[model samples]
Target: DTSAFIMELPAYHLPYAMTVLKYALDRAFSFVKRAGTIIFAMNVLIWFTSNYNWTLAHVDASQSILADVGKVVAVIFAPLGFGEWRATV
Candidate 1:
């Protein structure tokens, strides 16, 4: 197993291997603990971008916040040949 290799059970001192394992486990557990918060924040951003238009009205998808943002970005890149707002979106 990867954990076994990382711990080096037979090669390294038990305390050192355990210290490494503890660090790895702490990082993994922290990610798991923070996963829900991260997903919730991303979903809120996506929802805001997808549901609201430039005028802040709940309009059609084409007029959503993301589309407006894309159009603005596309203008900056238009001279570089990326002209289609939809493509930029």
Candidate 2:
């Protein structure tokens, strides 16, 4: 299949320095906000999973739900090396 398109265009001119800076800063801040929120959420999840058992009781890391899940994953990774539950996690 083939297609052709036509478009009108405005003449190009250099952008204002302040306008470019502002646009860059706005995009940077937006990215930082999204990345920060995701990191914060992941940290919270890791903390919760590593500190609580399936019953929700506070527990040591080795006894937490994360450890149980990691053990299962560790088995899958065993043939590839680094099979320890802690390493898997």
Q: What is the C-alpha lDDT of each candidate?
A: 0.82, 0.95
Angstrom error at residue 74, model 1: 0.7
Candidate with best TM-score: 2
Please give the range of 10 consecutive residues that has the lowest summed lDDT in model 1: 5-14
- Number of the top-ranking candidate, with lDDT as the measure: 2
Q: Cα lDDT for residue 77, model 1?
A: 86
Question: Per-residue CA lDDT of candidate 2, range 17-80, in tens?
Answer: 9999999999999999999999999999999999999999999999998999999999999998
Q: Considering summed lDDT, which 10 consecutive residues are worst modelled in model 2?
A: 1-10
How much does candidate 2 score in TM-score? Answer: 0.83
lDDT of 2: 0.95
Q: What is candidate 1's lDDT per residue for 1-89, written digit by digit as tens?
A: 56655643456545688889999999999998799789999999978887898678898767899887888999988988888676676
Clashes of 1: 0
For model 2 the local lDDT of residue 45 reads 95
Residue 60 miss distance in model 2 (angstroms): 0.8
How far out, in Å, is residue 38 in model 2? 1.3
Clashing pairs in 2: none
